[model samples]
Target: MQNFLDDNFLLHNDIAEDLFHNYAKSQPIIDYHNHLSPQEVAENKKFENLTQAWLYGDHYKWRAMRANGIDEHYITGQASDKEKFLKWAETVPYTVRNPLYHWTHLELQRYFGITELLSPKTAENIYEQASAQLQAETHSTRDLLQQMNVKVICTTDDPIDSLIHHQTFAQEQSSFQMFPAFRPDKAMQTEQPQVFNTYIDKLAEVSNREISDFQTYLDALKARHDFFATQGCCVSDHGLSHLYADDYTEDEVAQIFQKIRKQELITTEECNKFKSAMLVYFAEWDHEKGWVQQYHVGAFRNTNSRKFNELGADTGWDSIGDFKQGEALVRFLDRLDKENKLAKTILYNLNAVDNDLFAAMTGNFNDGSVVGKIQFGSAWWFHDQLDGMTKQINALSNIGLISRFIGMLTDSRSFLSFPRHEYFRRLLCNIFAEDIQKGLIPNDIPWIGSMIADICYHNAKNYFPFNDSAV
Candidate 1:
């Protein structure tokens, strides 16, 4: 058998090896969606240790450690950073079949040039070595991104954000570009009246507007959307359990907003109507500004109430949800398509059961206004692994045009996560090579390699409105 993680780790054939090494390996990354801290990038922050860089705020490892019977103290509590990382290293050997196993080693190799597999015996030595490198000037946050050849990153931001860090980064003239993606989920979240009203108050303060009715609220949010555009934002993102398409009149939505402002809990139907209206408004605004809008749906977030109360959201309590997505999604898109206000849209589903549903949904609204105008987004959240990625690619290739597809995003908070793009490109080239070996496709290396290159970098360069001058 071949050595583990050698030069051809994921590459399965001669064609696959050639395709990846030559065409896909060196492409610049376009991380279209991620949760990386703009402040860290702006300040060129350097991590004090490997744990701070790797384990801190990374719920992927936290979940794995918890699965390995690691305590909350060792995972996310007051345990020292080195202790936490030691727990993670102890758990690494047990993660043999998990994607975390591959990712952990991939990160260690890519970032620190460590070829030794991590374990309890070697954790201390590996940690000290990697931590020393992290302290170097060449290993700052910005430098890490440049080391991975990241060209553009779009961070998720709320409507009330100051974006001062983005402004600071813009003035620095770095090699990579960072842009903000407007994520206005809180602006329309009317679930808890107190929380909703509090968010509205913050929005009013940020937009410097008086909010009294639905019209004024929309105006304030619109102003922030305009400000985001001025700050070089060309994308919007929303997270939801599913699409909302409840029919309601403007007056009805206005009444619902008034009830929300008064801190009165609205009925479920009223909440849906208000959210549907807000979604339409956001999509229209995105279209008007020539922005790409993304929807990441079907996550049952914070399922464990006790842990959520202790740790809050996005700490790995979320799971894939089996929500009905077909009819309502069609209604939502058809509503915009009929009005001619549909912007370029990307749809990501957490449930793999909806793979074909999402892939087929793109064909319904791809009105030819743009190439792959309605895209089935990359496999997301729990589905970003090998089986998940392959199934998604196969579904899209069968039902839609994978040629026009924009490729992977880290969707990660760690700087070491850029190797996920490398992972995806290698897997993708292998798939094409396997098909060629089976005589399913012609053996046209240059032509197929060009397609691989486009999927790796060129497609995103052409799709996103980051820099018109980018090659």
Candidate 2:
């Protein structure tokens, strides 16, 4: 029987092992999208303990712990860090088939050199060892990223952000690079008039502009976008339940914005129209600046109202949403393509049911201006695990060019999450090897290995304008 997490962990064949070890393993990572803190990296922050480094702000572990009936205190409340970690250790054994099981051990082994499985039995010893290492200078945030061979990290940022951390990081000489990704979701969020106005006020303050009208608001946001470019941002991201493509004129959208500014509640139809207009404006700006625009859609967030009120959003209360994506998605892209304003776009769907729909959609607007310009992004959020990754890859391979595919990202807040890229690479190599064994593909190691290397790193390097000397 195969040993758990052995050298050939996810590699199922001899060819798979060879491809991973030789081609995929050594490629430097370009984590194109993630929620990592730029401040931590800039400061080179070291954790006081394993829990602070692992469990803090990690909703994935919180969700698992909650499933195991862990109390709120141990999960996210006022419990001591050690007590929280102990609870997590007690719950780890029950995570048998979950990806967290594999990820927990992989992180321990890779970062702390601990090969023992985590459980109640080993928790104390493991925690002590890892915590001690975390306190070391070599285990600081920057050092951890270096150890993982991460070449670039693009952190999510609000348009109102000063990007002071990114600026600070840029001044230092480091092997890896960090850049900001402009995420302007709040700029168009009109669901709550008070909240939207508050955000607009912040935007106005940051951009040093007056926002008396919709035109002025756009001017302020555009100024922020320009400032983000100065700080080396070349990517933009959006989080949405689904694409909005409602047909509305500029005058109507302006009036909706005015109502929002006056702290008046707009109807749902107006909200959708405003969002649709904002998306088009953002996409046009991205195209003008030669930036890549990403949309992560189909998430039904904050389902637990009580918990959301107590803990706020992104505390693991979100789930995959079933939304009608086809028509709106097509209309949105078609609108941009028709105007020649479509940026290099990546669409990530949280729901697995739309895997084929998303994969096939990319084909409609390739235009050959760029290779794989309209990409179905890597499996995201709830779909970032083994089964989900495989399904996404299979769908993309069947309908799109997997060779041109930019590969895995952590999409996580933890420094230790870089191991997810390794997991993805191994799975990818194994898939190709299995096809060769089945005589479905040629046994051309050199050719297939090149493709693997591209998917692992090179594709992203070329696709993103990261190496632009002007930046």
- Top lDDT model: 2
Model 1: per-residue Cα lDDT at residue 422: 91
Query: Which portions of model 1 miss their true places by more than 4 Å?
Result: 469-471
Q: How accurate is candidate 2 locally (lDDT)?
A: 0.94
Mind sharing the TM-score for model 2?
Answer: 0.99
lDDT of 1 by residue, 1-471 (tens): 878889998899999999999999999999999999999999999999999999888998999999999999999899999999999999999999788999999989988899999999999999999999999988999999999999899999999999999999988878889999999999988999999998999999999999999999999999999999999999999999999999999999999999998888899999999999999999999999889999999999999999999999889899899999999999999999999999999999999999999999999999877998999999998989899999999999999998999999999999989999998999999999999999999899999999999999988888887766333
Residue 224 displacement (Å), model 1 = 0.4
Give candidate 2's error at residue 217 in angstroms: 0.3
Cα shift from native, residue 366, model 2 (Å) = 0.5
Instruction: State TM-scores per candidate.
Output: 0.99, 0.99
lDDT scores of the candidates, listed in order: 0.94, 0.94
Least lDDT summed over 10 consecutive residues: which range in candidate 1? Answer: 462-471
lDDT for each residue of candidate 2 in 1-471, tens digit (9 for 90 to 100): 779999999999899999999999999999989999999999999999999999999999999999999999999999999999999999999999999999999999899999999999999999999999999988999999999998899999999999999999999899899999999998988999999999999998999979999899989989999999999899999999999999999999889988988889999999999999999999999999999999999999999999999999889999999999999999999999999999999999999999999999999999998988989999998888899999999999999999999999999999999999999999999999999999999999999999999999888888998875321
Candidate 1 residue pairs in backbone clash: none
Clashing pairs in 2: none
